[model samples]
Target: MESHTSVVLSLYRHGVTRENQEKIYIGWTDVPVAEEGIDLLMKTKANRPEAERVISSDLKRCVQSADYLFPEEKKIYHKGLREIHFGDWEGKKADELSKRKDFATWLEDPENMRPENGESFEEFSTRIQESWEMIREWCFQDGVKKIAIVSHGGPIRQLLTLLAPAEKPFWEWKPLHGQGITLYWQDAEAFRRGERCTSLSAVPIMEKENG
Candidate 1:
């Protein structure tokens, strides 16, 4: 077999919004960055990596953050990298949904019972994985080895959960807003197989002296 080709992905969670500040489950909601999140997002810029290209979720928050972080790089807007659609719960805070049994069920088994009209974990993972394959294929064919992805927490979490060295659940690998993680894939095929690659230490947005 041919030796595996490597690729580096610098994945970032987009800046926050007023809904995020209000502790709302802000998924599939097109809103701009909030006042408080401005400073947090700026910190991410200081930790920027040299990327061959930029890809962003089509959501306003990610698109705006991508432009701010990488003003010169070409941005490819893709909806496949969007946050999991919250559907009826798009704007509801966690506290507001704490009493709903469906919420509890979703927490335990998201693949079985999802939010009303929202995507199940299975569906979300499938689409994201497919999109990821396409992105990697495009990059590999173009002689690209590194790229930056500006996206939401949900998609970033999936990448982490799938790429983590040890097995973990969704909530266990939560990435903060504007925070990120770098994935070192064994090869492009690893992404398609959903196989774990080398373990990368989590990349925090505001942490200093990350050596």
Candidate 2:
């Protein structure tokens, strides 16, 4: 049998937006990264791995983030990579939703509850799964071994939950804005099987040193 090469995948959350600073839900709202956020994103290249391919959510924040970290690399953008569509909750703070009975119900059982005019947790997961399938095809047909993806918090968390070698709840895998994690698959078969990654590491965007 021929030996198969391994794969490395780096998944990053987009830099912070004004809505994020305000603790508002901005999923699908198309907000750009805040000014200070750009400074932080510029540091992502310091310790991050190089990639043969770069992918990002079509949303403004994610597109800008991928550009910052991999300026010369051509990138592929996809709407399927978007965060959970918050719909009516798109611009509201948690506190603003706190008093709504439906919001409370959704918080308690998000798997089964979706905000009015919004995506259910299952729906969001399904969309991400489709995106994962497309990525797998790229790996198989294109023989891609290294890839980077920049998306929102929710989608990043979902991808980690799906690929992390260790069992961790969705919330436990949180990557702050401008931060991310790298996942490794031992071989093409392992990746195709949808098995957990063989190992993982953090991809932190650290501060630059004083000149």
Candidate 3:
């Protein structure tokens, strides 16, 4: 929320977790990133611009990644930035639920309903919207012109709905592990009036660790 232009929002996803390597639905699972992921994050930290401040989800993977990237900076963590809660499906693999009727329905149309006691799409998006408003306020108050956010894919995708609506639907915006987009706005007025990102660009992930 700078006077000259909007803040540079560098949104980054957490690195690979064991569940991620296993291709599991890791919604709000609280798992740490693997060692390989840590190494990748350390390397990738060198690729991006220096951030004025850092924010992260309270989850383990995101917290760790933020600590690594901005060790000396004051890091803020909030639960609102966490991934969608899958409820009973928290740790299940995609293939494991491939045949379930609800899974198919949930996958086919995630916006209209919830997933087995999990948060509905509305719930998820609403939290993200509220969190983003809070984050923007923080930036405006602190005069923070550049910010970095480390979070999970679900929140990133949900936030993208506000940041880059034309990008794709939630599921279609499946950002890779340790990858996210940098969204730019014009100013506080544009941000408040709900303007889309002036530039929507992906931060490429490093080559996958040799498994």
Candidate 4:
């Protein structure tokens, strides 16, 4: 891994989805972002014009977001950056799931709990970790000092655990739609949180045909 104090990563969550608007859990469904989401992505890209590389999950929503932001170039698509697989609960409502007896227990200890047909927390974390490793390699090889990644909330949350395992609660670190967290990786080993910026709600969505 190439190590440099100048390396920075901008992590962004995919824009609003139909599930988000409907208040449903959209774990790994290959959903597309709403028109509002496309606008948010364009604004995000404008806000970070200095980014040299753009990467995103292979899922439809993320790919759409990345395409809107960096339409001229091909983005790095990594399956490891995809959202958590909710298994049988892929499109269910949170409140509905919470009504079940196993819901509270599952939420309390997600690291070990697995939804009826969904992935365990450990499985999700491991997938993101693998993506992180790939990210490091890409940064090193390209000598990239700054890069932007568009992905789902689950992967972003998991990446936070790898970068900053100690300060805030998991709930507190979750990335909202169109929000971004900046991280610094020095000498290929030292990782730390940088300033986090939220421009999703502040920016206007650009109206463009879907790619």
Q: Pick the candidate with the highest lDDT.
A: 2
Which residue pairs does candidate 3 place in steric collision?
none
Candidate 3 residues lying further than 4 Å off, grouped into runs, are: 165-167, 204-211
TM-score for each model: 0.85, 0.95, 0.88, 0.80
Q: Write the per-residue lDDT of candidate 2 for residues 32-83, one digit (tens) a residue.
A: 9999788878887778898999999999999999999899999999999999
Stretches off by above 4 angstroms in model 4 are 1-5, 185-211
10-101 per-residue lDDT for model 1 (tens digits)? 88888778888888987888999876666777777777666897999999999988877787889999999999887888889989988989
| Tens-digit lDDT track of model 3 for 60-114 | 9999988877777899889999988888788899999898899999877888858
Q: Which stretches of candidate 1 lie over 4 Å from their true place?
A: 1-6, 185-195, 204-211
> How does model 1 score by TM-score?
0.85
1-211: candidate 4 lDDT, tens digit per residue: 3444556677888889878988787888878899877667776666544467888898998888887767776688888888888887778898888887766788887777888888888888877887787776667667677777889887887767556525555556768796576765444434322322212222233345577
Candidates in order have lDDT scores of 0.79, 0.88, 0.81, 0.72
RMSD of 2: 1.6
Instruction: State each candidate's clash count.
Output: 0, 0, 0, 6
Estimate the lDDT of model 2. Answer: 0.88
**Candidate 1 clash pair list:** none
